[model samples]
Target chain A: MEFSTIIQILDSAVRLSTPLLLACLAGLYSERSGIFDIGLEGKMLAGAFAAGAMSAYAGMPVTEGGLGMTWGMAWMGVLAAVAVSIVLAMIHGFASITLRGNQLISGVAINFFAAGSTVLIGQHWFRSGGQTPPLSGAQRFGPINLPFADAVKDVPFLGPIYEGLISGHNILVYIAIATVPLTSWLLFRTRFGLRLRAVGENPGAVDTAGISVVRQRYAAVLIAGILCGLAGAYLSLGTSAAGFVKDMSAGKGFIALAALIFAKWRPRAALGACLLFGLLEAIGNRYQSIDLGAFVVPVQFMQALPYILTVVILAGFIGKAIPPAAGGEPYVKER
Target chain B: MNKGLPKWADVVLIPLLSLLLAFLVSGLVVMFIGKDPIQAVQVMVSGALGKFGIGYTLYYTTNFIFTGLAVAIAFHARMFNIGGEGQAGIGGVGVAAVLLSVAWPHWTIAIVAASLGAMAFGAAWAAIPAYLQAKRGSHIVITTIMFNWIGSALIVYLLVGPMQAPGMVPETVGFSAGAAIPTLHDIFPAFDKHAPANVSLFLALIAAFAVWVLVWKTRLGYEIRAFGHSEKAAVYAGISPLKIIMVVMLISGGLAGMMAVNTVQGEAERLILDTVQGAGFVGIAVALMGRSHPVGVVLAAFLFGILYQGGGELSFEMGIPREMIVVIQALVIMFVGSLENMVRIPVERLFVRFDKGAA
Candidate 1:
């Protein structure tokens, strides 16, 4: 492949992986704190719908049942997405924590709830066949050019790479990229991180250390909600399509979970795993099929690659993937 | 948990109360969307149970029964098999291959052969995840979910490439007329002729009974329940975890695959892209609400069947999306499966008070 072609692919990979990166980090927090979250997909879907609907409403005129605001109101959309996702995360926490119900069951229920409610309510409110109105102009997150992108464009080999691959994404993409290091620091270099990791691996020890297990778990779940909300917001507002379509998240949340497993639940590794999955997706989107000398590789196979790789990783064909010891089990304080 | 409640109440009443709670929450959702909740229920009932609609209701019920039993069997082995969607999809491929291979002399022989093909293919698809869980220590939930995506992709590849008919559509050609199963209308003569309810409904009932026999009356059934209750104790008793996991998953996968017979050979009569729809996930709700009991599965499956048929009608008449049924299904799972203690504890307390008063 030419350097320019490679750069283009990397650009697409970065764009596509933003959501996966956000959701993967979200899972990292939740899973690291001993709560197995299967509902990340559901929460992301709900957040996408909330952000899409809210942004569309904000952009429209007051006469048409909107807030009559401009680009500034897009922030409100992000806030709405976060709030809605947090509510759902709290519901999952309530079911698995307070009620001590099966975490998997709660996750399954949340997924269905989000899948159904988003469409049902969207159809009721917007009447657009379960889609938010298409967004444009300031209503969506337009790409931002880095300071020297224009100046560096004339420089041969390094110019295109810097401009095309590294710079010029919506703010959410930059936030998603920045979040990787921030998450690594929060998870490994902080006092709270120790307690969080301890709680996931050995809640009994955390309890003995005079920490409140329930509070820590709920906090982790909340952070997961916030990160997932950013992922959803990016899906709806940051993408070029710039509006919510039905099922637009389209199993990305699960892919993020797969990336989490592939990464062995580490922050930096999650970025690499997500980007690799994203690169596969970008290649699939760019080409219908690749002609090899002997056989053709179909787009369907490319689309299915991440899932296949995740299964391979999980089966220990690559490496052993072990979850936190206390993950997925509700903690009951022994009297 | 049910120390104060009678056996009958534990088996029957708690579920009913939970169902009521689910419906109540669903009603609130309907009302929140500015629809009349009572009118929604009324419409759902008439549309699902009315003469013409009952046929469709039963058709959906047939699919649910098969998938629900699949989940229930795995639940008995203490495994959560969420790949019913993929298993059923591949089962359709199996049905199509069988029905399209050659001309059959009769529908009876064809249906039997196709059913076997469906079961085999479904079991084959599930075997990897089962083996991984049993031997490699992989999480079955994650692997099965990945398998669901992979299965769908494989189906898409098949439909678009080798299986594609001469036309532009990405579907297989219709099966031979001899391969088609008898619809409910052909047998009853009074049923709706347009509806898809077919001889496979009887198969579903038979499968339910067979599952009950397999889970309760047989030695294998005892071992499964024992393993489900306590894996350590079951292993101590000489029951191998590997044997139970593999056998249970194969059976579960086979049961889920049987659903394709109803949809493929009986109704659609061809392999299409979304053959399983979301019926696989609906099975999870049914199994949870059914408490993994055969009798309870039948009842819960019927309830979901009504919701599905009625929800379709609701979308047509009231402009409510058909997804309303999915929302209700979620609520039922939440109440019956996840939040069971919320209702059970209060009910247990009430029963304890009543017992004290009697004493």
Candidate 2:
């Protein structure tokens, strides 16, 4: 393939990788703090719907210098999306923590509710079974063309690699990249990070050290909700910002969860894992455009790739990766 | 907190509260759409219980009972089995393979072969996760979930490949008359007009009783419950976790497979793309709402069946979306989390009172 083509592919990869990265990081926080969060998909769906509705109403472009009003509405949408997703997360926490219920069941319920409610509400508002109205460019994520990268656009392979491949994606892609080192620092190099890790690995030990296990897990899971919200917004606003489609999250949230587990809950490793899966997704998308006759891989098979990989990895093909000791155990205050 | 109600009051209270809470949430959604909430609820009730509705609802409820009991059996063994959907799907394939491959003179023989095929396939399907958990110490929750996706892919593959019946739209060939469940016409003349409520309900009820007996009256059941109660203590007491895990998963997968047979042989008579639907995941809610008991799952499944049957009717009549039933079902599971509390508080109180009275 030509350098430009490769660059284009890489650019698409980065764009595709962001939502998964954000959601994976979000899950990293929650699962690392001993909270199982299968509801990341639900939270992301809620955020995507919220962001789409907000962008639709906010980007009306009134002639009376309405920048303030527009920005305010957009911010309100973001806040609302985050707030709703967090409340759902707290419900999950309350069930698992307060009621000592099964974590997986609670997460499944959250996901089921989110999927159904978001679609039902979206259809009601948008008058479409699945999709929302397309946002204007002003209402959407715009790309940034870096000065240095632009200057070197004509420099053969290097130009394509640095400028065309990685330079011009939307703001959210950059945020996803920034999250990696930031999450790493938060998980490994900070006090709160230590406690979070402690809670996952051994909540009783953390509780004995005077930290509240339930509180820490709640914080971790809420962080997961916020990040998943960003992921959802990116789907409807940045990556595929065309509209809010029912079930449009399309197992991506589950894929993100898989990436987190495959990475063994480390942020940087999660990025690498997500990119690998993203490559598979990108390949599948590309393959659909090709006419390969009967030899063509089915879309359903391609969709199942990440999940198949997850099982293979979980089945000990990978080296012994372990979860925190208290990953699914509810912390009960027994004093 | 104790206001001196009967010891069993809390057990009954949680489901009642959840029903009330779910209605409130659903009521807001109804009002949001400018519909009459009370009228909508009334329609739901009548649609589920009306003469035209009860038979179909009961038919669907049989599958729910099988799947719910499938899930509950595993829950008793402390294994989180989420592969019911996939297992059921695979089991449908097994039924198709059996029915299409044979020419049977006796209905009983065909049904028995189909059931055996389904049980074998389902057990083997679940064995993957069980093997992973047993050999590699992998978590069953994570592996079983991945297996669901694998199972889905496998079904899709079969539908498009060897199992695909020629000249049909994404569906397998219909089973032979012998392979199909016999209608209850001769046995119950009064129920001759009932559409699809066939002999499968008897099978389902028998399965439920079998589950109850195996879980409560057997030594193996005692071991399974013991392991669920405390893995460390069970292991210390010489129970093999690996053996129990495999056994539990096999039984769970087999039950799910039987549920598929009921759907394909008793209802559809062919495997379609929408086969099994989300009944497996719904089974988790049923198991939870039923508190992992056979009788509880029966009641819970019936409730779900009513909701599904009513929601289907409401969607056709009032133009209200059938997806609303999903919202209600999810809320039920979310609230069902408090079942442990509902169970614990009353049991503890009863025991304390009994001790005090003796003293």
Candidate 3:
């Protein structure tokens, strides 16, 4: 491949993988904490809508509207989204943990509620059936040009890679990448991590040891909500600056679940899995752009790739990838 | 008053409570939206119940019975086979394909072939998810949801592409005249032209009875029920979960596919002619609301059928958004999710093995 084309591919890959990475990290937090949170997609969509609506209401000031939008304002919007998502995730945790309801059913219910509430609210607020007004380009995330890339433009591989792919990414892309090791550390190397893992594998053991399952799961779900919120923000503030549309998260949350399986529920492994699925999705979308006329792949088939791969990965490989022993079992404390 | 009538009262009571709660909550939402909540509800009710409303409601109920039966059958085997929607799509496709390919002159042969073809296709579709679950120990929930999306896209591609009937509006070709379900109007000279209710309703009723017998009266039923209670125990009894999973999923899928006979053969007369709609998913709510009993399911389906038919009529008469029906449906599912919590009173559990009878 030409050096420029290689650089282009790398750039596209980062952009494509951002949302998946954020979602996987979110899944890691919740599942690791002993809550089987299958409602990540709903959480992310809610966050996206919150961010989009907030931006629209604020009316992009010309100063903050440009691609050079300060890190502060973007972070503020992302933080707000996270806060909103956290509230919703808390509801999920309350239902599953506190009420001892069926986690799967509760999660599905959350998804339906999210889907309906967001659309109804958005339609009323924006006077549209779906979607918010697009953010001004100034308000949208733009590329960052690092120092020395200009000087290294003459270098063969290193120069092209630095100047082309890594330089122009939006802020969220960097955050998504950095989260992998951070999540891994949080999941495997800390006191909290041990407790979290113990709760998932053997909640009764955790409870016997005096650690509260409710507290641990609530924390885990909150972390999940934050990450999901960031993922949502990336879709609106980072990718398109377009408002949230109905069912905008699509099936990405489930794809993240698949990534967890592909990674064998390990945070670091999940990064590779997310990247792989993202690569498939990125390639599938571009297949039509670079067509082999006789070998034309239908868009429907192409779109089905991630889900199909999920099924294959879950059903074919990953032999004996067991979840936490007490994953779906609700803990009831006798007063 | 009939014997065991109090038990039946609970059945009506629970759904009615859910309905009332959904309406009240939604009414508040409508008032917030600056619409007349009372008028909106009035329009919705009259539209569903007035004049020929009963006919359409029964037609809608027919689809629900098949979908609900499909879901309940799988639940009895402890399988969460959520691919009813996908299976329905494929089944509808099979019906459409048969209608297009068949040159049969008799309507009876064509209708039977379409229905059977649909059931077979649905069974095969569900088997894929069941196989993944039994063989690989993969969770069926995620796989089945994926299959629903894939199935939907497949139908969309086929209908708008290769399966497109000539001059049809993004739909399949019209079925042969012989393939149409014999309408009540044809059987009764004085029948209403506006009402097209057919014999599919009777088929739904018979299917419910058959399902009841299958779940409660036979050795296989015992095995199925045993598996549902505890898979490990079922395995200890020498019953293979793999075999049962496959059998139950296929049976469930086949029943769900039968909805096409009601909709395609009975109403639309061709599959590609319309969208798969959400009957299959709604079936889940029906089964849950019915507490997974065949008799209860029929009643629940009819109640929902009325709301669905009436909701549309309300939209026209009272100027409420038609989507209000969807809101209500979602509420019903929500309430079903919380029903166990709502009824913490621990009434008699009928499905559990009877100690006295066993002794």
Tens-place lDDT digits, model 1, residues B1-359 = 56868998887888889889999999999999999999999999999998899999999999999999999999999999999999999988999998889998899999999999999988888889999999998888888888999999999999999999998899999998899899999999888889899999999999999999999999999999999999999999999999999999999999999999999999999999998988888989999888899998999899999999999999988989988988999999888988887888888999999999999
Tell me which residue pairs clash in candidate 1: none
lDDT of 3 by residue, A1-335 (tens): 67676567667777877888898888887887677877888788888888777756565545755333433555556776788889878877877777676677666656666676677666666667757767664445677778887999888888888888777788788888888888778778899989988888888888888889999988888888899999988877787536677778888888888888778788778888888888888777666434478766677777787788888988957567877777877887656
The RMSD of every model to the true structure, in order and in angstroms, is 1.5, 3.6, 5.0
Q: Which rank order by lDDT, best down to worst?
A: 1, 2, 3
lDDT preference between candidates 1 and 2, better one: 1
Pairs that clash in candidate 2: A236-A241
Query: Residue A179, candidate 3: how far off, in angstroms?
Result: 2.1
Tell me the lDDT of model 2 at A23.
87
True contacts kept of each: 0.80, 0.56, 0.25
Query: Comparing candidate 1 with candidate 2, which one achieves the higher TM-score?
Result: 1
- Candidates' C-alpha lDDT: 0.91, 0.79, 0.77
Q: How much is the lDDT of residue B87 in candidate 1?
A: 92
Indicate the TM-score of model 2.
Answer: 0.91
TM-score of each model, paired residue for residue:
0.97, 0.91, 0.89
* Best candidate according to DockQ: 1
> Which prediction has more favorable DockQ, 2 or 3?
2
Inter-residue clash pairs, candidate 3: A65-A138, A65-A139, A66-A138, A66-A139, A67-A138, B43-B314, B48-B310, B107-B178, B264-B269
**Model 3: per-residue lDDT, tens digit, B1-359?**
12222555466655566556666777886776567887876665666566567677777888889888998888888777667888888888878878778666887788779878889988988988899899998888889888888887788778777887777467877888878777666676455566656777887898899899999998888899999999999999999999889989989988888888777777777665344577887787788777779997898898788877877776567545445555666566655654344432232233232434556
User: How many clashes in candidate 2?
Assistant: 1
